[model samples]
Target: MTAILSMLPPDWREGTFLGRLDLGEGPVPVLLAGGTVHDMSGAAPTVADLVDLGAFDPAQGSVLGSAEDVLARAALLSPVDLQCIKAAGVTFAVSALERVIEERARGDADQAQAVRGGLEERIGGSIRSVVPGSAEAAALKAALIEDGMWSQYLEVAIGPDAEIFTKSPVLSTVGSGAVIGVRSDSDWNNPEPEIVILSDRHGKAVGAALGNDVNLRDFEGRSALLLGKAKDNNASCSIGPFVRLFDAGYTMAEIENAKVLLRIEGPEGFLLEGESRMAEISRPPLDLLRQAFSEHQYPDGIVLFLGTLFAPTQDRDTQGRGFTHKVGDVVTISSERLGTLVNTVATSRDAPAWETGISALYRNLAARGLIGGRA
Candidate 1:
């Protein structure tokens, strides 16, 4: 395989150690040390020799094997060993031949051809108008590019009905690299635990932005006997922060202000008032969100939910209580600087037809002042 090497300065490999391969262009070489990659500049004897020694079967690139092997080799080498090869300076290289070969064998054109023929035969020309340029059409194009297989680039968070935590908020790190912890109770006390992932970005939270603590009350108060398996009985869950940070370019300060808002709607389509007799909170919506993220060490993002807002003791069987979310309930959340993000997650329950019934419900609700307009 043909290799391309990017050279560095004479002292680039001096006292620096290799961790893993960092793909970039710079004087600080990306070192493959201790099964990870890091950027550093120092003097080293022979950069080429070090690279060869760190090489291993790419197919064995699992977390335990190739990763461990890479780390082990770097740990065995001393500073003196690196200094002897300083004449070669430091250089980062990758096999161009291997990359090209992999691309041609798995490129987009070949897959699209295969699917286009089959789709045309089965569905006639119903799908021909759905070209791959538009945003909606891109999903099919992506699927075709991946050879009809489902591909996901983010980790999902899961928990029982009781746990309010989602996979998104917690930050998990190891050695240097990190990912967002999407699973519930991933690390109970760590507050912000490392999710153990390999990526190019640093200093970002992963998974969902925020989760509700109310989901965990039942489990926290229950007896040991009632808690079956610890994994099965947990409550609530979320995921994000990991891919979103890379995707959205979130900074630590920006993440701090992310928050959630809860709105309770009564039968008359008005917000329910808080009663003084109940345990009440008058904290501004943003304040509640800021405090939650700070207290839980949530790095960034918002996980807002607008569901039934009645207190637990309130009569849930009343007319308003029976009203689940409809198409018209307007939910709006905003930050001082971040503006607002709004969406409706409701659908008709008794709609027999797909298009007409659903559209009619939303139109009717809008007329009743349940949707549209400023919140």
Candidate 2:
């Protein structure tokens, strides 16, 4: 087992710290403190686990044993129930590279260049001030100096197949053990959500966690008109190590200072690495919360992958050197505040089949002004 390190609240460590672990007896909730595990077997057997117990307060129980002893015996479940994992659509972009990549993949050179030109022009590059026809015709500049690029991205919905296409956050699930299982090869996916904001029954932001909005680049590259295929799938998303509940004592400065580091490694060596600040996120966590539930509802709890600065993708210069994960690959998104989320790559064996016909319908609808953005 690879080691996962995160700051367990020092205060909670004395007595109140709690988590659920499977000790081969079955999945049991445990009270953790001082490197010890307090037995919660059959204890939560009725109203059951921590979430139902509310606040994770441990009922009086005998000490289970050393933390290592118990952890060694059990598998860790995601800290949150994860009824559904939702992504705020297009919340951030390193540049316009997302669409640019997809457009180029379609073998449409002019449109691809147009996408880049439009973005570069918005940031006021040396590119003719008028729209340049060729990559060489423009200076191609801008350093994320302006927030306007991605600040107003409209949230969209994600569906596993084309049938549920809509401009709203999509929901995907992870399998047991919090694995982001997928049928595609490793390099095909990317993760988002520099900050994972958690909300309660009323959709109010309540806690924070580390999350991976796993994306299948193959699906994404096929068409920008639809993100559902690339966005949602069984075990395509995962969150946790633990969640950091929001306290009144926490401040905006602390939130703004949060840093997200995306790291990936294969059987040989490091592959991709990038860092960004929470403040760079177009929608603040709180603001994203408001946008997320504006139309939908989550009675249990909701997870919002706020956004990210840039994704670690294949180099734009070399088409073949693209980004994708393979078997045995490990990807980790770490944050001091939210902790660390780690996933080892493995292609899902029994995943289901999905259709892409709906994307074409969505593109048609978008062009007719029936929906929000275009394809």
Candidate 3:
């Protein structure tokens, strides 16, 4: 328990955080401020409601306990509720390259190394230097297409538009300390550690959190149509410890310059570490946010994952197989200002089924008198 709590930011006590906490009754919105975790149920029914309201005062909330004591007695949820979960892909040069490798190899781990070497030699430097949608990017694209090296991944990577997709349904995201799932049948897969933005009903960026976007390389590699199977699954999306609201101390600058770190400790004594510097992203974070909100509405709110730059390529067991998660592997994602998110890896087929959904949440809230009635 101590170790899990230690995953939080070193300076957590000083920051303002919003999250969901289940103290055996049901999940309730919690506010951590002035070194105490306060029950914000009096302020709002759900975190989504509190965020949409946009003016919650911690002093008005009832004191639960110190942050440590409260977290110790309760299970922390995904820090988001009733919000649409969205994600951007191929926002980094390395991720774009990996997607191309996955496509060329057709999900075959054995063929990935061969394709990786050729792809890197062909357009690696060019891709890194050119800005997405720029004339230089267009010239490079034309050259790659002429050379027969163009890919759908590259088109999205360097194209005028970004690739934004629904990551998971509302109330489906598991919190830190919960088991994160990958497809059982997927032989090639990895965890994507990213910094997620919390947007209000008005599509305004209000806060940020850490997330593990567990992915199945093999599934998506076989066909783009398998994206649903490869991406969304039971226990697949893990976000939290908590969402740190943007304030005078922790602002957009913290998120813009944040260095998201990943560490995986396998059951068999395999250790791997990597990082994704926000500085290396091909598209600005807000640009992706605008693209996601373009011609759409998320009245409840949204949790948007700014694509990761850390795509593990280290060999886990087999020499050329690259990195693939094993059951019991502990994945930790942390940033200086946003704190840490830790979760264990499990096969989607074996992990606990996603039972509590929007209906269940509404019923629980209504029964607890947290809300008027179920929608």
lDDT of each prediction vs. the true structure? Answer: 0.24, 0.51, 0.89
Scored by Cα lDDT, where does model 1 land? 0.24
Scored against the true structure, residue 326 in model 1 reaches a CA lDDT of: 30
Q: Give the TM-score of candidate 3.
A: 0.98
TM-score winner: 3
Candidate 3, pairs of clashing residues: none
How does candidate 2 score on lDDT? Answer: 0.51
Candidate 1 at 238: error in angstroms? 12
Q: Which of the two candidates, 1 or 2, achieves a greater TM-score against the reference?
A: 2
Model 2, position 108, has a per-residue lDDT of 34
lDDT tens digits by residue: candidate 3, 223-255? 988988889998999999899998889988888
lDDT of 1 by residue, 16-125 (tens): 22222322221122343233434322221122222333322222223323333433333111111111100000000111111121123242222323443343354223
Which regions of candidate 3 are displaced past 4 Å?
1-4
In candidate 2, what are the lDDT values of residues 1-375, reduced to their tens digit? 543223343343433334455555333446665567776543543112334445444445567777666666667755544234555654444423454444454523323444544654554233123222233322232223243333111112111111112212222333123456555533355666456665675776655666776666556555765466566565566666655555545444556678878777777774877776775543456656665667676655566666566655454334544455666667777776555677776665434222213355346436544446964
lDDT of 3 at 153: 95
* Candidate 2 backbone clash number: 11
Give the C-alpha miss distance for residue 174 in model 2, angstroms. 4.1
Q: CA shift at 248, candidate 2, in angstroms?
A: 5.5
